[model samples]
Target: MGFLMDLIGTLLRVNNLTYRYSSQDRNLLEKVSFTIGLKEKIGIVGPNGSGKSTLIKILVGELTDFEGNIEKPKCDLKIGYLPQDVSRDSDRILLEEVKAALPEVYKVEKNLRVLEKRLENDVDTEVLRDYGELLSKYETIEGFQLEEKIKKALSKLGFTKDDMKRNYNKLSGGEKTRVELAKILLEEPDLLILDEPTNHLDINSLEWLEEYLRRYKGTILVTSHDRYFLNKVVTSILELRDGKSTIYSGNYSFYIYERNLKEKQAWEKYEEQNRKIKKMEREAKRRKIWAKRKEKEKIGAKDKGFITHRAAKLAKRAKAVETRIKQMIEEEKVNKPAVEKQIRVKLETARHSGKIVLDVCELSKSFGDRILFNSLNFTIIRGKTIGIIGPNGSGKTTLIRILLGEIPADSGFIRWRTNIKIGYHAQEQENLNMENTILTEVKRENSDETFVRIVLGCLKFSQKRVYEKIKNISIGERVKVSLAKVLASQPDVLILDEPTNHLDVHVREALENALADYSGTIIVASHDRYLIKKLADEILEINGKETKYFPGSYSELKSKVEL
Candidate 1:
């Protein structure tokens, strides 16, 4: 009975939620409803502009103008929300920032110090009792081990001891995000909400986070585009589509399986309902025709009374059938299933080049005294896909820049074969002009406007959206535009840095299909394990001060390393 009561306790419940931007005509979320139980780990997933972030803000009480009844926990509920972008304006060092998360622990410690000073002069019984009680409370919250926890969290997030001493304001955006994540983990609120928490984490840090969240005692609600992270961290999936939310009782993989089955079932039900409705309509039409003929006979018959009675009976039966048909149409109407758009990218390559696409020997790069990589040697052959995997600041992007001659290498030799046309996709998307329209950007590669529009359409860009400025579009749309430009350029060698970063799962799969079908040499640096595993023929594992090449898929390499 106790277990059942606990199970019935709701952490958060939203009913008949309806929201819309004041400037927009239609609702962004219409009558959406769901309940999250205590200690449940739920993942929210959807395409860009599908209101995932907006819904999260609503749940966290940042926005309250919507029409709904949001039933929060009756007791004191501590909610820690980590937004997609974190402010990096703190003057404190990394360690100090994390330590500040536990203000209560410090307050208690300060009280203990004052009480000890009082005891040194006057040993009052009440004072002693207060001090003992405070001490017990501090111990219960593990205040004594605060430093240890801070250090462990920082280390797991790929921050070195030296990094802990560095000022938080001086760190990069990704570094600041990681520091904020560490602080959130240490805070450990009753409800932990993270938006794109895996954005800046590497494979190792991602693994650490997955493990940490698995053991977390509180309820967790996270929004992520990382398939592998979602699979590992979330116990259930909440998918938002067409302004509605659907809850699936399993992880991301299970959601995929169940969603496919559900879609198929929905389509079948729609078809079956259509067939039944058509049959009923036909029967109603036949009854109406029979009633009309009987009426005509009643008007023309010599024995008018008998013909009139029969006509009346036929008309009543037809009216009954008509009412039944109207009821069925009103109550049993079926809607067409939703269809997701697919991105189609084709990278047209130049004529055949030499067998060796790119060869690097004894490559080394550094910033001031910090070495990103040293003595790195790798070779890429034609028609091969090489995935570069590493922690952040490990020289993956630097190496790409060096090959493109955009930056000078400290010491290295990069040789590309003749007739090799390189198409580069920067991780920061610096190659794109933000002020340019999508059509304008694509026109830079190909002058034919009609062809460009067709290409954009294949990438799932509508005709109206093609004229919008790139800066006004979502990150995923920007990625698609960049991809379209790259594909239009017809490069023999493609160097992409984190290509799948802003893309949703469906579009990511579409890109995977496109790359798999490309007949050119491809070099990509990405944190998305699913993409890497599916598309990479070889793996370039870059650790600090060294680079190693593994011959096989990402999964094989992962298994070998795990062993």
Candidate 2:
């Protein structure tokens, strides 16, 4: 045992793991194997429906009944998991919610409730004594200072004193995530697992979480689509593709470099293997024909016995070889490169807009007495990309809506010149009809089925997948559907909000490339720094109180930001 620890010290190993849903026809994760080192920060990334979340659930024991062995480095290794959609009652107070997770406080509260119910039926010395004892137990657990302790935990996550009284449900999605993360961190577990942790966090909150995690003492396994976040926080990346695990020993940028090289090599091997397979198949067919001809000739031969015997032997050998080839083809077929796992989109514009796409002056918006932003002024040029960035609830979405005329700005002078058609992708996917099928959603009033299908096929939707309801598909698939509509429009201007929210890295890169190649004006509001860095030529930074504009790449804007 001592030697084992010395060789693979504090490693959590998963061996030959396989799992599937009860309703599925095949295994979602088949024979997947990987290991987590002590104090290692690893990011698990893959396209949607590739079993990243399934593997996480299996490791955290939320899913049992799988065929495999999970060997923990320590017998009592504690794991803390923060799942997707940790949002609960928004009406609950912050302090109460945090304290509810304490087992001791819950026990005392349970006992007090029992005593109170008993007293309602009949008062007795036993019930009174039990109630008083539970109260004393609560006091012993430092009940008076419990709120303060919870408050301290929340404060580090950027919560204020006034926020404690505010409704938890009313907070932005990013704030809700922070509140849930605080609960998980209070457990002080040895392994911290997070799923889609950056799905809602703003740029500021993302940086804070990345810094906090870099200084953490425990092992971290996070699944996220934010490439920049993964590059900044994790030392290694575990990619799940085709029901298998491949671990890269560096950050996301390194993984991309190595993965591209590996993919090129894999594709070369695959093409060569396919050629060999075709050759073998041709030889088998030729031999089968020769055996038949030999039999036909033997039927008219003088020495029929010997000829028949030779033909039978040759045919038997050929049949056995054919069976072997079939088995090889079925078992040894090489998987294609993962880079092929992306949507094919070409964003084209039919007409050219004027030099000025949008002109705005003295733009201001307020919801009740809370000012989201005021006196915001910015100009968008034709054929240029502008990225809108800000914290959650800081007027990023509101600004997009105001420009699209979906919502009204309190006071502003906005002018749109020389642009007729506009394609918009909303953050919440509200533009899509949830009840319709994916095929139906992408079909326009005048578009034919063939045209719509061709568009969906470009988005990687198979024939059967296109028929699935929009609500039944995964979030990534839905994003693709929305994108299919947006690209099909061929508008002069495009505006997207949180376009990369639920996309995997492959699709995100595809969207980025399509937008980069597009020769039209673009205004996108997103927290994906990588996308902004890749596509944006100008940056509009909103901070709830005012707006700051920088006419450069995202990296240049960051360099100009003061510490």
Best-performing candidate as measured by lDDT: 1
Residue 360, candidate 1: how far off, in angstroms?
2.2
Cα lDDT listed for each candidate: 0.85, 0.81
Q: What is the per-residue lDDT of model 2 for residues 80-148, given as tens digits with 9 covering 90 to 100?
A: 788886656746777666767676776677677788999999999988988888889889977667667
Q: Where in model 1 is the C-alpha error above 4 Å?
A: 1-8, 109-141, 271-331, 341-347, 448-451
Quote the lDDT for 528 in model 1. Answer: 92
Show model 2 residue runs off by greater than 4 Å.
Answer: 1-8, 87-92, 99-158, 167-176, 273-343, 445-455
Query: How well does candidate 2 match the true structure in TM-score terms?
Result: 0.78
Backbone N/Cα/C clashes per model: 0, 1
**Model 2 global lDDT (CA atoms, 0 to 1):** 0.81
Residue 151 displacement (Å), model 2: 4.8
